[model samples]
Target: MSTWKETLFGDPFAVEGDEIDETAQSEAELLAKGNVFEQPAATRGELWGYYLYYNGDNGFTMNSYMPNILQSLAYMGGFYYDGNTTAQNCNNMPEGAVCYVPWAGGSIPVASMLLYIQAIAFSIQFVLFTTFGSLGDYGRWNKWILLSATIIGCASQIIPMVWVNNDGSQWNGMMGMMCIALISYGASLVFYAAAFPLLADNLPVVRKARFDPNVSREDYVLVAEKWRNNVSAISTTFSNVGFLIVTAVLSGASFAPWEKYDFPDGVAHILGNAPIFNYIATVFCGGFWIINAIPYFLWVPAGRGGPQLPPGENHLTIGWKNIISSLREARKLRYLFMYIIAYFIFSDAVNTLNSMIGIIQGQITSFNGTQITILNLVSAVCSIIGCLAFLWIQRWFKIRTKTNLLIIIVLTAIVPIWGSIGIGSTKFGIHNTWELWVFYVWSGIFIAPIWAWQQTMLAELVPKGKENLFFGLFGVVNKASSWIGPVVIGAITQSTSNLWEGWPFVLGLFLIAIVIIFFIDVDKAKEDIRLYLLENSDEASVNGQEKSIHSVHDTDRPVSAKDEKFV
Candidate 1:
C-alpha cells in the first residue's frame, strides 16, 4: 500500500492503477517513518482551503453584500423607479429627492422585482446544480471544474458594479447580473460540498507496524469521525470570523452614508444617498473571493481518482443517472427523506429571513447602512460563539443531536414572532429600536449552531459511498423551496404595502419545520444506513473493486426494518 503522501499529493494527472516509480516509493517510505499523526497531507491542505473559501464567500455573499449592501441597492432602485413616493408607500426611503421616481415608464414594486429576480436566478441554479453536482464523482478534473465555477462566480460579482448605476436610473442590467452571480455561486457550492466526503473517505489509515498498529478498526472509525467534526467546526468558526472582520472594516470606513432625513414639498423624505458604495463594496468582495480561492486550487485534490465510468459514458450521462437513482432511492430511506423535508421548510425560512432582513429592518426601524453593518457584525460574533458553545455542549454534556435540534427549533421560532409583533405594535414591550436590535442579536446567537449541527447530522446520516449524490440532493432541498418564502413574503409586502405582514409567512414555515423534525428518528436512520450498506456492499464496488469507506462490522447488531422507530 502507498503511504499517505504518495496517495494524497500524488500526480493530479495520474490515472488509477498508474505504476509508481521506485524512487518515489522509497521517498514515501522515508517520509512515513517520521510522520507521527498519519494524517494525509492533502487532507490538511483541503481543510485550510475550506477555511479560506468560506471566509471569502461567506464574508461577501452572506454577511456583507447579500443581506446588507444588495438590499440597500434594491431600496435605492425602488425609490427611483417604483413610483411610490407617499410616506406610507415609501416609509424606508430617506428625505428629499431620494423618493423621486426618475424612470419614465411605469414601475413595479422593488420587493416584487427583487423576488422575481431571485426566483429566476435560483431556478437556473437548480438546473445547473443537477448537471454539475455529480461530475466530481466520475471525472478526474473536479478541481478544474471547481476553479472554473469560482472564476465565473467571481466575474459575476464584478459585473454588478458596472451594471448597477449610481443613480439607479440605469440599473436595468442589475437583474441579469444578479442572476448570473447566483447561478455561478450555487454551482460552485455543489462541488464544494461534494468534496467533503471525498476528503473524509481518503484519510490515511494508520499502519499497525509503525504507530498504534493494533488499533481496532472501530477506533479508526472514531478517529475519522473526530476529524470530520473538527474540520466542520473549524470551517464554521473561520467563516464567521471572516464575516465579522469584513463587516467591521466596511462599517468603520462608513463606505455608505446613513439615510438622511429631508423635507420636500412639506413631506418628510428619507433619502438614500451614496449609491456608489454598493458598487465599490461588491467589486472589493469579488476581488477578495478570487484571491482567497488560490490556495484551494493549488492544494486540494480534485476527484477521488478511484474509479471512472464505462466506455462511452461521460460525466453528463452519469450525473443525470445518479440524480434519478437517488430520488428513487429516497423512498427506501423514508426517515432521511422526511429529514430533508424538514430541512427544506426551515432552510427556506432561514434563507428568506437572511435575504430580506435588511429591507425589513430599514422599513420598520429606519436602520441606516452603518446600523445594518453593525447588526451583521453582532450576528457574526454571536454565530461564532454559538458554534463553539454547541461543540462544547455536545462534547462535554453529551447532548443528543435530535434533542439539540429540537431545542434550537423552539428557540428559533422566537425570531419571526418577535419581528411580526414588534413591527406591528408595541404590545410586546418592544417599542424601541434598541429592543429590535436585541431581538435580532438573540436570533443570530442560534443561527450558526443550527446550521453547523444540521450539516453534521446530514453527514452522519447519508448512506455511505453516496455522499456526493446525497449532498447534491441536500443542496436541492436547500435551494428548491428557498424561492418560495421570498416570493410569498415579497408578494405579501407588495400587496399589503406593509413589509411587517410578511413576517407571519416566515413564522409559519418555521412552525411547519419544527413539526416535521419531531418525527425524525436519528438512531433508526443510522441503522437503516448500516443495513443498506451490508446488503449492497458487493454491488457498491467500483470497477469490480471494493472502494467504499463504509465498512460494516462482523459483530451482530440490531438489524431489522421493523426495528425502525421514531424517537
Candidate 2:
C-alpha cells in the first residue's frame, strides 16, 4: 500500500498483464505528454476547501433564506397574502397590493417573482455551463475557474449588506444580485462536481486496480465506485457542516437575544442597522467560506487534464464543440444517455418540488428570519447526518451505486406524494406549520443524499478523460430543465391562487423519472463504457477536432437487440 506521501495523482490507467497493442491505445489515455498528475494525500484539504466553499454560494445565496428575503420584499412591494381574496394566489390581489409587476409584466403574483428569477438565472447559467464548462479540462484552469466564480458569488451575497430598506425599495437591485449570485453559484457547482471523477480516479486503491490488468474492468470500476461514494458523501457532509456552523453563529449574533442598547442618536438609522445585521450574517457566511477555501488554491496538485486543445481552439469554443460531440455519441453511449434523461426529468420535478415547498414554508413561518434560520440550522444538521448515514447504509448493505440511487429515488418521491395531499384538502399535507418542521427534517435526511448518490453514479458512467465535458453536460441537463418546474409552478400558483396545486404535477414527474430509471441497465452501461474506451481511446484526445468525434460516432461496431433500447 502506498503511504500518504506517495503521489497518487493522474498516473495514467495502464494494463499490466495484457499484451496491449500500441496502435489500439490512444496516446491521449487520461493524461497528456509530461503533464504533472501527481498530488499527495494533502489534497483532502483541497477537497475540503472546495466543499466548504459552497457555504455562501449554496447555503446562503441559493438556500431558503434568499427566497424568504425576496418574498418579504415582494410583500413590501405590494403583494400580500389574504386568506379570503388572493390572485391564482394572484388573481385576487387586494386593491391595496400591486397586482402587476415588471420583467414579464401582466398580473403575476408577487410571491412568484422569485420563481421567474430562478428560471432566468438558470437560463443564463445554461449558456455559461455549455460555453465555459469544458474549459477546465484542458489545463489547470479548474482551480482558477472555481475560485473566480466563488468570489463573484460571495460578493453578490455580501455586497447586498450595503443596501437595506424595510420598504423593499431596493427590490430591483436585490433581484439583480440574486440572479448574479445564482448564476455564479451554479457555475461553481458544475466545475466543482467535475473534480469528483478526477479525485476518485486518483485514489490509491483505484489507481492500483486501474493499472492491474488481472483486476477485471468490473472489479476496477467497483473500486472506483466505492471511492466515488466516499468522496461525494464526505464532501457533501463537509458542505452541510459549513452550512451548519456559519448559519448557526451568524443567525445567533444577528438576532441578539440580549436586550438591545439603543444606538447613540442618528446612528440607529445608519446603514439601517437591523436589516444590515441580518445581511451581515449572510456576509459572514461568505467570509468564512473564502477563509476556508484559500488553502486549496495555494496548494494541492491538479490531477489529469485531458488532451491539449487544437491550436485554434480556445476555452469558449472547445466546450460547445465537445458538447456537440457528446450529443452525437448519445446513440452509441446508450446507458449514459438513459441515465441523463432520467436525471433531467426527476431533477426538474425535484427542483420544482423544492421551490413549491420553499414558497409554502415561508408562508408557514410568516417569512420570519429567525424562524427560517432555525429551519436552516435544522436542515444543515440533518444534511450532514444524511450524507454520513448514507455511506454507512451503503457499506452495510454492500450495495451498488445504482441500487443506492434506486433507494434514494424511491424515498425522495415521498416528499411530493405527501405534499400532493394538500391538492385535495388543506387539513393535511404541507398545510400546517408542523409540516414545515417535518419537511426540513425529512428532506434533509432523504433528499440531500440524492445529490451525493447521483453524482457518484455519474462519476461511474462518464468516460475517464472526458470527466469535465460530461460533468458539464450533467450541469447543462440540470439547468436546461430546471426552469420548467419553477415556471410551471409559478403559473399554477398564479392560476389557482393556491400553491399546493403544483405538487401533483411534480409527483407525476417523480413517478415518470422513477420508472425510467428503474428500467435503466447500469451493468450494461458499465460494459458499454468499457468497450467505448477501447474503441475510441485515440479519439478521446483533447485536440478539439470535429472529425475525430464524428469518427467516434460513426464507429462500425454494431448494436444488438437489447442494447437497442439504450441506443
Best by lDDT: 2
- Predicted candidate 1 versus true structure: per-residue lDDT over 164-209, tens digit per residue: 4454444445556666777777666656655654454344432221
560: Cα error in model 2, Å: 36
- TM-score, predicted candidate 1 vs. hidden true structure: 0.73
TM-score of every candidate relative to the true structure: 0.73, 0.73
lDDT of 2: 0.64
lDDT for position 503 in model 1: 78
Clash count list over all predictions: 8, 8
lDDT of 2 by residue, 1-567 (tens): 544333333233332443333233233431221112443332555555545554333445355556666665665565444565553223244443333344455556654676788888878888887787766555667777888988887787777766655566666677888788777777677666655556555545555554454555456555565556555545654665566776677566645643343544544333223434546566776677678767666655655344456689887877778778777766578878888888899888778777777777766655555666777778767766887898999999898888888888788888888987887787888878788888888777788778767777877877665554565566668778889888888788777756677788888888888888788787888798878876675565555542222111111111010100000
Off by over 4 Å in 2: 1-58, 80-103, 139-147, 191-237, 258-277, 296-308, 398-400, 459-469, 526-567
lDDT of 2 at 379: 73
What overall lDDT goes with each candidate model?
0.58, 0.64
What does the lDDT read for residue 138 in candidate 2? 56
